[model samples]
Target: MAATSLSLQIDARWRAATTPPDRPCGMEDIETASSSVVIVRGKEADGSGFWVTPSIVMTNNHVVDHNPDLKVGKDFPATVLATDSVRDIALLSVPNVYPEPVPLRGIEEMPRLADDLYVIGHPIGRNLTVSKGIVSALTNDDYDDRQYIQTDAAISSGSSGGPVVDRCGRVVGMATQTLRGAENVGYAIAWSQLSSHMDRMLKVVEGSSPEERELTYPSDQTEVVAKYYSTLGAGELAEAYDFYSASRKARLPYESWAQGLGKTVFIRLVSVTPGDKSNSVKVHFYSTEEVNAETWEWRTGEFEGTWTLTREGGLWKMNESNIKDITKPTTSP
Candidate 1:
């Protein structure tokens, strides 16, 4: 579980192309691509994890199994959502929402051999860092159906569960291990091998507990309103988006929802009550916002609204948010 240093053979040609004249690509560019990565520390083991969904973080199973006190709902920073030891993958439910989730590239989307790649994680318990390399080959592993992406991306003892991203910043694999006694050689669980496991893991996350079910797939109208606003208030746009009716979300799109509410500072739930209609919930809340990222201007508003909800795919979702008025946006001088 202890951390070890690693050496990677950075492709000189690729590095030159990615790096700017004054600013090198190694530290700055890698850090930007690592926004979704988190330092996962347990009692016995510590590693890295990347946000796959608003609430879910993906890492290696061995990392969790090595930790003695880390368990679902027992840990402070995160809880176990699901694990597949055979596949060496684990999903943890984190408390804070990530600004964005790492885009998971599917098997069909695998990059070509010799393409530049980057692995981002906290190596040797250091702050998140990046190592550069090239895809050497695509090879099958001990597992019958699993495939591995061979790369020279420098990864160490603490790098397990971190992401191996393509030049375009799409996650192509999860750094799993490095060949012992070898130089600049590492192995990753390809997205092709991970996609099926991820599908099953998410289902386990939704069905594991009643609280999770209510949070992800509520049957009651009150629960739908409560969960949606709560997630939104926490800045969990992707998870909150799931609480929207498919049709409405399709029309608005996640990108627009994120941008529209980008300046939201906070949301306070005042009350939720049954509406005139059976599937609607009247919601009351107060919100604060920054007018712009550059300016210090602030505004406060109250939203009195009724959310029309409907059942879809066995979960209650809000079809629309009808805010009657903002009650005057009080600006700070």
Candidate 2:
């Protein structure tokens, strides 16, 4: 059966708050709706996704780009199940997730001019962020000639794949992109525009794939380590800590390891390749590190390192790092 046909309206239970445009939505309703949002991280893209079904997420295709080792919400492994890249839409299988699916508006209920809309996303891959705007002008923002929902709402970087929900908390559209150097000009592809496509995509009957997915040689290995460095450079010590193998964590306490890493402010990944063996990755990077933590003077350096990761509980954790060939740091992205 199709997940969409004639029924796409917000449930009667949610309609109670629809009459008041200025009144805040019920806290329980908004929180549950927001919980459907998730962080999407791939080697090339960072954005947000939302649960369209219990086990399936909808996002912008540019966010995943068919990345094999995509991570959704707190590092949960994800797989690209479908994509219509031209439309900037994609769906992924995210097993063992608990966020509830959100409602979508019917075509008859499409937003009109000045209709209030709220964009919920994780801008810059940060926490849940929401921006408010009205339906500006409905027109083609791309070559597809499809009508896109243009809003003044900030769909800044990292918020690209998030949900654009209505005042009733029903998903009206999917945040797609923003124009550089342009203010408050962001485009979204409405669900009503792709209801048929989504109806089929949302039927996620496949069982969860095994959590311990092996990397496919060079490409996967490089991206895995690169994501680690990306997190490190962002000063996400707690998240980086989880990447360490249990045995490695046993040897190096979090405080000590974080203290050591604190010396560097940022790491710019240059090149990464698979090592001679399947378990290793070689990295060439540049760092802008603090010379003295107190004075905060920084120095740049070029570096090379080999990282060994151990498979544990369906994920790879860092086992060892062999860093050498450290010439003075000049920056390379």
Model 2 lDDT tens row, 284-321: 88888888878868888788979997777656667998
Instruction: Tell me the deviation in Å of residue 311 in model 2.
Output: 36
Tell how far residue 297 is off in model 1, in angstroms.
Answer: 73
Q: Give the TM-score of candidate 1.
A: 0.51
lDDT of each: 0.69, 0.69
RMSD of 1: 21.2
Candidate 1: residue 100 Cα off by (Å):
7.3
Instruction: Tell me, by TM-score, which candidate is best.
Output: 2
The per-prediction tally of clashing pairs is 0, 3
For candidate 2, what is the lDDT? 0.69
Q: Per-residue lDDT for 207 in model 2?
A: 18
Model 2 residue 5 CA deviation in Å? 23
